[model samples]
Target: MEKFSFDGPPVGDDADISAECQRQLLSPIQEIVKAAVAAGWSRQDVLLAMVELSWDMYEKRRGDL
Candidate 1:
């Protein structure tokens, strides 16, 4: 079986950008959510994705210690 890996967003050594850059990034996220809803992603799907992402983060942090 193939293993899955996730690379989380940069947390260290990344300088904070300007507010405009943040604003620009928000649009793509909004578009994807709009697309997801259009493609019939249910409330449960969203919730499950959130849970999985949180679990992955927890496991990675635990393993890093």
Candidate 2:
């Protein structure tokens, strides 16, 4: 992943911007969990898979760390 920094003017108050960022970040995970559940996956299994995937991605992104 590429590093990103906001160099432009502020879009909103910090609290509002942070809240929106949290919502945006979680939206995809919520959808993924919903789909997994709908497809008959247990919540535990889905959560474990999510954790594993997150760690794997983190390792990949932080190569040689």
Candidate 3:
């Protein structure tokens, strides 16, 4: 497993730019997802795993430690 931080445009400035930044950040994930599927993991399984991992990151960002 690998951990990384994604820092993008600040919150609540411009919606279009914010959305575009999000799209760019998430774009690379598609290739990794395809690789995961090729490695025999179901799409749903991979999605769920990502969701769980995102929640952990969210919690930590929220200072839940």
Candidate 4:
């Protein structure tokens, strides 16, 4: 995985932040899907798991705010 530093000025606007967040989020999901596939999970199973995980995270973060 590549390391990203944001120690300087803002990368751009809200769109840029959203894009970066998405890229960072999907990077881990891609890895999880690959590992799950290798471990005998179907593509649909992996996708369902991803959806559930995303919703769980969203709910948790929403509560934190």
Candidate 5:
């Protein structure tokens, strides 16, 4: 399929919640990794999360290319 990119608002111009909230929202994802290590989550679970994160990042910056 063909893809197109949209021009986005300037960074940091978001009216959304503050950066602190963003950090808080994501901190748990890190904790989840450590806890999962102790709890013995399968390697597949950890790797799947990584793949999802990578794809999300690629989409986020697709406009730059």
Candidate 6:
């Protein structure tokens, strides 16, 4: 698989920050997911765990912001 890369928003461009952030994050995230699957972890389980952990983190951190 090719490594993901993002050039980022152009100078003075008002790109969607959330989308840009996701693009930047995808490369490492994909690497981790692929590695986890290769190491005998089922994709469904890994994805479900990610969703559960992410939701928990979001809920915990929501109060801070």
Best by lDDT: 6
lDDT by residue for model 1 over 1-65, one digit each (tens)? 33434334445556455444555556655665567778999756765786698699999899789
Better of 1 and 6 by TM-score: 6
Number of clashes found in candidate 4:
0
**Whole-model lDDT, candidate 5?**
0.67
Identify the superior model by lDDT, candidate 1 or candidate 6: 6
**Which residue pairs collide, candidate 5?**
none
Each prediction's whole-model lDDT (CA):
0.64, 0.74, 0.78, 0.76, 0.67, 0.83
User: Number of backbone collisions per candidate, in order?
Assistant: 0, 0, 0, 0, 0, 0
Of 1 and 4, the candidate ahead on TM-score is 4
Error of 6 at 7 (Å): 9.4
Better of 1 and 2 by lDDT: 2
lDDT string for model 3 (22-52, tens) is: 6776856776688899999998899899889
Ranked by lDDT, top first? 6, 3, 4, 2, 5, 1
TM-score of candidate 3 to 2 decimals: 0.66
Off by over 4 Å in 4: 1-10
Rank candidates, TM-score, best first: 6, 3, 4, 2, 5, 1
Query: Against the true structure, candidate 6 has what lDDT?
Result: 0.83
lDDT of 6 at 11: 50
- lDDT over C-alpha atoms for residue 45 of model 5: 90
TM, every model: 0.38, 0.58, 0.66, 0.62, 0.39, 0.71
Candidate 6 similarity to native, TM-score? 0.71
Q: Which stretches of candidate 5 lie over 4 Å from their true place?
A: 1-36
Which residue pairs in model 2 clash with each other?
Answer: none
Q: Candidate 2 — what's its lDDT?
A: 0.74
Cα error, residue 58 of model 6, in Å, equals 0.8
Per-residue alpha-carbon lDDT of candidate 6 for residues 1-65, written as tens digits (9 for 90 to 100): 76566776635567587787877887787787899999999988988998899899999999999
Among these predictions, the greatest TM-score belongs to 6
